[model samples]
Target: MSTYFISDIHGCYREFKILLKKSNFDVKKDYLWIAGDLVARGPNSLEVIRYLYSIKDRTNIVLGNHDLNLIAVYSGIKENKKENYFDDFLSSKDSDKLINWLRSQSILKINEQQKIIMIHAGISSQWDFETMKACALEIEASLLSNDYPLFLKSVFNNKINYWNSSLRKIDRLRYSVNAFTRMRYCYPNGKLNLICKKSPNVVKYPLLPWFIISNKFKEKYSVVFGHWSTLKDTRVPSAFFPLDKGCCWGGQLLMLRWEDKQYFYQSYLG
Candidate 1:
């Protein structure tokens, strides 16, 4: 059986399905790893979530920022934004079930056998792989806990840009969530630059792509991430793979066959 990695579905269900067909993905045999953002921006958030839920056994997912926001909106912690186009999804009868499933999903996944790490956004330059994994699990625990609504309500803080082990539990969780779902750029000293969403080339120095900064993790793993569609053609090291092709914004959807690293693209028609 083969494995595939893709990200930032953004409710582009048509393109998502077409890309899978184009890649010859076999649900029974091939495993699909989704870096997340299963909803928002496209016309079929409901369809996208339903299909993923149907095939969840064959798929592995990590929650993206949009996905987390969807959960927050559903829990009444945040309002549903019109631009996100989540009405159909939120109004669905299965919305509660879907959101619960999403909450149970983790923020990070590691395949030790393949030496691959799958996350929605970039990793923190200040955290080693083990620390990253630990922080991710901590967030996952919070998400799945009974107090998840409270967690969602407090998780969006951007004030804590730097990672500190001694920070309060909530602060640490928020930082880890941002690092895993919203991060793009980092200051020279390893602080998160969460406000900037532009591509790396256009941004001046001291605000480099998170991957460009050094971390304590040994150079043995490849990080497969999504969430920064603006990264577009920005070339990163071979160890870092970005799969967001901006499909919901009139761009194409991309899928990478993990076995051979072959990429498949499906241009958006809607």
Candidate 2:
């Protein structure tokens, strides 16, 4: 069975399905890895969630920032923005079920056998695979816990750049969520910038892309991520694979076949 990776779909249901068709993805035989942002922005967010849930057993997903935002909004911790276009998704009868499934997804996915790691955004340089996994697991656990709404409330709008073992439990969880789903740039010393969303070439000073600062990890394993659409076509090492091509912004949906490292694309249909 072939494995394919795609990310930052952002509810572009038509484009997503087109990409799958373009790549000849066999639902019964092939596996799919999604780097998240499964909803928001584009039209048909509800349909995207329904389809993904139906094939969940054959899919691997890491929660993205928009996914987390949807969860928080559903839980009444955050206000839903109209620009996210989540009205139908939130109003659906299956909204609760879909949101629960989303909450159950981890922030990071690792295939040790293949030496591949997938996250929504960039990995923290301070975190080795073990540390990253531990942090991700913690966030997963929190989301699954009875106090998940409280957990989401604690993490909302909170940003933690540096990792400290002595941090409070809530703080640690917040850091993990942000690092896995929203991070973009990092300071020279490995602290996350979390602000500048511009392309690396346009950004200077002490800030560098998180992948650049965490090159050591990339050298050991292929790091696949999406959150940064502005990262389009920025050449990096072979170990780094960025799949988000701004499909929600009228670009194209991109997918990578792991076996041959082949890239597939489907232009935005919306």
Candidate 3:
């Protein structure tokens, strides 16, 4: 039984299906770990979510920023923007079922046997495994709580853009969410730079990719993450693996077989 990791599928349902068929994924034996952004941007968000929902038992997903935004919009905590592509999904009869299941997903997962960590985005350089797990659990609890809508509403307004163990309540949760779902570049001191979305080569110095600046946990565990599609080429950090190949942006969708570290790709045809 193999375990495959993929990320940033956006809404390319056809490509998702093709990739699965090409890989000959066996649902009963092999497991799938999605780094997230399972929907949005492409043409078939509704179908994509429905397909994933059908295979929920065999799939492990960590929520990405777009997925969280979908929840916020569904919960009436945020306004849906026209540029965002989920109208079909929102109008579908199974919308509620899909949204609820997506919300129930986690922001981080750890495979101790493989010595790997899966997150939608990078974790803070300052946090160790225990602290990262604790912070993630705090947000997970809030998302699963009865007042989750309230939590979503509060998360966006707080400007606590850095990680601090002393941060309490909403501020703490918001920081954790951003780090796990939206982070790319951050200062060496663990202060996040949320606006720079360009490739790391073009990004000015002093602002480093989270993986490069994150020293405390460097080389400690293998990290598989998505969210920054602009990162085209892979790195040799030995611990950092970025799988978002920008399939929704006319690039290829990538999957990594964790056991052998081999990659498979499907080009965007939509």
Best-performing candidate as measured by TM-score? 1
Candidate 2 structure quality by residue, lDDT tens digits, 135-216: 9999999999989999988885446778888988888887888889889988888887777899877888788888877446
All models: lDDT?
0.90, 0.88, 0.86
lDDT of 2 at 155: 88
Ranking by TM-score: 1, 2, 3
Instruction: Report the CA-based lDDT of candidate 2 relative to the real structure.
Output: 0.88
| Candidate 1: tens digits of C-alpha lDDT, residues 134-198 | 99989999999999999989889889899988998999998998899999999999999889999
For candidate 2, the 10 contiguous residues with the lowest summed lDDT are 211-220
Candidate 3 lDDT (Cα, whole model)? 0.86
CA shift of 198, model 3, Å: 1.0
Off by over 4 Å in 2: none
Candidate 1 vs candidate 2, TM-score winner: 1
Better of 1 and 3 by lDDT: 1
Residue clash pairs of candidate 2:
none
Tens-place lDDT per residue, model 3, 143-213, is: 88989899988887436778778888778888898889988988878788888898976778789889887
Q: Please, what is the TM-score per model?
A: 0.98, 0.97, 0.96
Off by over 4 Å in 3: 234-236
The lDDT, on a scale of 0 to 1, for candidate 1 is: 0.90
